[model samples]
Target: MGVSALAEGGSGTSYPSHREPDGSIGIKLLEASSNRKNDPRAYLYIVDHINPGTRVSRRFEIRNTSSSSQRIKLYPGAAEIRHNTFVPAADRHANELGSWISIDRPELIAPPNSRIQLNAKISIPKSASEGERYGAIWAEVASPSVKPGSAGNIQMINRVGIRVYLDIGPGGDPPSDFRIEQLTPGRTEVGMPVVKATVNNTGERALDLGGQMWLSDGPGGLNAGPFRAQVGTTLAPGYSAPVMVMLDDRLPDGPWQVKLMLESGRVHHTVTGTLTFPEKPATWGLPALLDSFPLWALVIVGSLAAVAVAFFLVLAVRRLRRRRRVAQ
Candidate 1:
């Protein structure tokens, strides 16, 4: 896991680009468990493991980035990992996890360019199931009332939130792990090269996937990127999904060495191989010659074989000299 500064309303940066023009609001996690201090996800979300019948509290901060004051509403909303995505339910739809959460300040008037801190308390029942749940702590702002019959007078609402991934169990926390199953090279409809790595969650907990890919040993020795893996892919326990990396469109197809690194929290995995993007635009290519065999592994095997052959040849020459000497 890596640590990053909490973004104002988005991922990684203090000021996000998608701020609403009228009045933008931001929310971020303010506290993380000491055990997970090094995990970046803990600073961006409410990620924790709690025992049954235990009570826990987490603090979060909200910001008003607009010139005028804004009224913000805070609550817990349902979320689920569907199709490898963390999907929050529509309009504050409630779930078991959301029901268990209680915010100390549900509504507040945030002064212009000011920040407010709030506390959320979660109480797990003794009979709670031994599994993980997903939800979000949301801060929302709605447009002020528009005059009747005004042009395009539709009121809009914008909300930003911190995700919550909570696991309820007894005793020790469940282990988190995953593996890269396969890699496929393809192109999007617009001819941009893409590599999709199939990943499987092979442990008892969910994973929020992130990583990077580097290309080398290309045609004419022309090396390419350390392109970033696309984010927002979450995998539930025992499920599989694709983590995609989109490469530069102008990159040439070649027998390029690919090094991919993927991680979630503290767990990390690296995979290396050779790949050539599909020549046909928008199509996925067949597996390359060394798709399954890594270049490093191949080099090591070849070096060992060469050493063995050289030793055998030396022995053969010595034996022939001994036979000739005996004949003489």
Candidate 2:
């Protein structure tokens, strides 16, 4: 089903927005939210090699574009790098690092065209050991409820966050690194081909692992997929996990070569290997004439060829005799 919207005064119509007069709300990490285009860490705060027992602060801005007022909620949650993605913990407080973050203003009301600046303090404990921790400060806006008698009274909310990374200790540098132990090519439960990379965290710090992948099928090096490595695949020191990239589309069934490039902060690594598909090439019920066969099949075809040759020779001899009789 489709729906339409009209202007309040029946003057003109356009798509709907949560706010009246199509107003909007914006959240930015200082100047802007992460465009995620050129700068991967544009909206993220990176406190590199900062010693424990120290304090730091992070600030952000939220603006209301609508004519009416809006209430914005803020909170902090633990985050991890896994499966080539940035994954955050649930609303519940879980990560020990997240406990160090203190949000002074949890809620604020912003008038139309107003920008509100908020601050959060990171108070690291003196006993904090050396390693890296992941977390995020999130801002959210929720839509109002539906009318009294509607099909569903569900409300929609949109949220965005700024990622935070802290390195703790006196000489706090946990060998910012990890390694790709192996690349195994196989299929998923649904029979889709996937290249699974086994990775190990060799450093003392937890690493958020993710990367890009490229695949070439067959001898011509025909490119298939540039699948990305799993993001937010977090691994503590002496830990391991499987980072998988699924070939979700249809491609020629053959041997393929996969190249992967992985990175965490300043650390980056690239690896390449071969993979074979589990499924065979599609055949439209055609006979297995070109397919590999047993010796019995070969012998049967040879026998049929010899029988046809003998029958043709006998017919030629009979025709020659008939011609001789007519001439006599």
Candidate 3:
């Protein structure tokens, strides 16, 4: 979800990384499917749905940002969505989808500060199952210090990859959607404003949750943010997770109209509510009454109800006047 870089160590810990000027090898998607051209996720990873017996191809690029030549190994590895995370298998393991994927070049020597494009093809057998499969196309580089077959030495491997989400079926792609269950406003221990949205994946496919939140109608009519939801939270079907958006610390804490939009590919949902942060740190406050409804919709309904009430009152007055005249 965030910018991926070379992951070091097999220590069973997840480390965050980004490309730097000091030389790093990286991987990226080079092309997206024509059918999925409009979907942002398609451009980031190998996301698609195809029949069991068909094959699909995608292009990707690997770059050597160092000053010296590097030996890069290309391969497909096992991956799974466990506990709402895309976990890559350890040590070049293979899954169903990973076995099906073939890189045109398994290994290559990359010149310094050079780029190489390669094609990865996935050929599904006729017996493939009718569900989604997960894997990754990885580019790994080993540290030069670790000589080959150095049994007693520790070998550090740094690799980057693009995720794969491939669904096998006979018909069209499955529906992808989600729902926002609740919104809570809070402050961090240091008093930074934050909003936590509980989201549920209510569809047949997994969701990559990402979106922006806007705050308006605050104290003194002040407004804030189109703040982004921290990326990297993925939800499997029937799963629920919290998506959070942190705001500027300088923002005042009372009665803000919040609008949040979340999506996975083309499926999107918008939620509106009223929130206020609590006075204490690391505390949460509930949304105001009718906070789930948009303000504009509420105003329209209220206006219609007022007109109906006025018309009924006018009829009542006329009927009373007629009764008085008849009695006279």
**Best by TM-score, which number?**
3
**CA deviation > 4 Å runs, candidate 1:** 1-23, 91-94, 146-153, 288-328
- Record all residue pairs in model 3 with backbone atoms less than 3 Å apart, i.e. clashing: none
State TM-scores per candidate.
Answer: 0.80, 0.59, 0.81
For every model shown, the clashing-pair count is 0, 14, 0
What lDDT tens digits, residue by residue, belong to model 2 across residues 1-328?
Answer: 2111111100011111112224766655552222222333333343345577877666776668878898877877787665444567654376766688877798888898887888877788888886677777767677776887788877777665666666677863556567776676665666666666777777776655667777775647688666766544656677888876766646655566667777654567777666566553221111112223434457889999999999999999999999999999
Candidate 2 achieves a global lDDT of 0.62
Ranking of all candidate structures by their lDDT, best first: 1, 3, 2
As a whole number from 0 to 100, the lDDT of residue 282 in candidate 3 is 85
After superposing candidate 3 on the true structure, give the runs of residues whose Cα lies further than 4 Å from its correct spot.
Answer: 1-22, 91-94, 145-152, 288-328
Q: Assess candidate 1 and give its lDDT.
A: 0.80
- What's the lDDT for all of these models? 0.80, 0.62, 0.80
lDDT for model 3, please: 0.80
Model 3 error, position 249 (Å): 1.1
RMSD of 1: 9.7
